[model samples]
Target: MLRSIKARKGWTARAPDEDFAGAAEEWNKWFDADPSARQGAKMPVRIAGMKVPIAMIAEA
Candidate 1:
């Protein structure tokens, strides 16, 4: 996901004031727009301190 954001044509390092929720929404849009981006991707649930086999980040 970080790689994809960096790979975007005009993405610069996010501003200091930027919030994660806004960025996540934007990235989610990108992820959904391009079907290929989902191939073999396993997104981690970082909001949780401990790793879980299945963590929910967003509503499906």
Candidate 2:
């Protein structure tokens, strides 16, 4: 079943015949988008009725 869509932390568009970030045509419509949309998001984790704010950390 298709689930209802909610606001996403980030997004990207890929072409059928193209790999990610290889060609300009596969780019998302918005190139100059805000970086905070992907990086500044806070994930809330609940434990024992306590809510903790967690930040997304990507491995380089």
Candidate 3:
């Protein structure tokens, strides 16, 4: 599934159990290191009423 998502355009497949906080920190560091890295990048979505995004499910 991760590989499938990775194959798609404009999608990033982060691991389910990945340290999200650490990832955020790392992302911030990367952005700081190179401001151009943030260009055209969208912020991650935070869906309310559910931990995971609605799109994760087969049926919404």
Q: Of the candidates shown, which would achieve the greatest TM-score relative to the real structure?
A: 3
Cα lDDT tens digits for candidate 3, 1-60: 322221211213343435455545654553443332211222365445433311221212
**Candidate 2 local lDDT, 1-60, one digit each (tens):** 111222234433332333333433322243334222342222233246543233333323
Tens-digit lDDT track of model 1 for 1-60: 433443323222333234345655665675555422221223333354543232122322
RMSD of each: 12.4, 14.3, 11.0
* Segments in model 3 whose C-alpha atoms lie over 4 Å from true places: 1-11, 33-60
Native RMSD of candidate 2 (Å)? 14.3
TM-score result, candidate 1: 0.27
Ranking by lDDT: 1, 3, 2
Please give the distance, in angstroms, between residue 48's alpha carbon in candidate 3 and its true position after superposition: 30
Looking at model 1, the pairs that clash are: none
**Top lDDT: which candidate number?**
1
Give the distance in Å from residue 27's predicted Cα in candidate 1 to where it truly belongs. 0.6
lDDT of 3: 0.34
TM-score each candidate. Answer: 0.27, 0.19, 0.28
Residue 29 lDDT, candidate 3, scale 0-100: 56
